[model samples]
Target: MTQDKLIRRVLKPVVWVLCLGPLGGLAWLAYSGGLTANPIEFLNRYLGEWALKFVIFALAITPLRGLTGWAGLTRFRRLLGLFAFFYVVLHLSSYVGLDQYFDWNAIWLDITKRTYITVGMVAAVILLALAVTSTKGMIKRIGGKNWNRLHKLVYLAAAAGCLHFFMMRKGVQLEPLMYGGAVLLLLGYRLVGYLKKRRRKSRLAVA
Candidate 1:
């Protein structure tokens, strides 16, 4: 089979299983009395982490594909991005349902007044937009050029997610720092590629 077919048929299914395994594990943990003392916080924080992880994974696709010369990797990007959005929704639900018990006024206060929550909400909103327009129908409706432009918002969403995670911490922690650094590296890679493309375009114009 061709590489692209292999990626689509074999690797994509494997990736799907791995990506969703965490949610299944969480359910098992909850059922088995393994969610620790603060189950709500555990689930909220855990789901948020997985969502950020998928975001980073989606962002890493370009650099990884460039380095490995595997164009087929791009096919998996939409799936990864959608999973990120899925987890974000779950994270929000956990926070509202379990943590706040659907307290709209308090939730509004937290979203508006709390720095970490506010930034996290901003990131969630950006992800929601990307998720809503992730379909082929939406792409056709928006036009490919416009869709590409709108999807670039993922970079800002990632940055905001990192900042939210960092600010949510009680003190200095290495985990958030590492996530921030990874995001910076991915963004730096994109910047370098953009500059190279611009330079190539300029050289072609001169020629």
Candidate 2:
């Protein structure tokens, strides 16, 4: 089979199932009474952690593609991004519906009072914008250049997410630091690429 068919017909389905595996595990845990004493908190944290992980995975795709010369890797980026957003929605929903019980007042207070929640909300908003404009129709309507510019905010969202995770945790934790380091490395890679491109263009112009 052709590469495209392999990706579309076989790999995509496998990846899709793999993406849902976490949620399925969560469901099983819930049913089996394994979510710990604070189930709501556990659910929120678990979903939020997975969301951030998917976001990092999506961000890594471009760099990975460039390094490996596997352009087909781009095909899965959107799917991973959407799953990141999906888990983010579930994380937020758990906080709002299950934890807060739709208490808008308490929610607003938590958002205002808790720095981590505020940062997380900002990240969520950025992800929401990216998800909304992820469609082909939206891309055409916004123009390719504009859409690309808007999507660059994914880096900001990722950074904010890392910060949110860091601040949400008590004391100095290793997990958040590791996540933050990964984001920094990814951002560094992009910055180096941009600088090299600019230098190459300048040399061509001079020549």
Clashes within 3 Å, all models in order: 0, 0
Clashes of 1: 0
What TM-score would every model get versus the actual structure? 0.95, 0.97
lDDT string, candidate 1, 29-98, tens digits: 9999989999989999999999999999999999999999978889999999999999999999999999
Model 1 misplaced regions, further than 4 Å? 2-4, 31-33
RMSD of each: 1.4, 1.1
Among all windows of ten consecutive residues in candidate 2, which has the lowest summed lDDT?
A: 39-48
Alpha carbon lDDT of residue 102, candidate 2? 100
Q: Each candidate: what lDDT?
A: 0.96, 0.97
Per-residue lDDT tens digits for candidate 2, residues 1-207, read 999999999999999999999999999999999999999899999999999999999999999999999999999999999999999999999999999999999999999999999999999999999999999999999999999999999999999999999999999999999999999999999999999999999999999
Best by TM-score: 2
Error of 1 at 41 (Å): 0.9
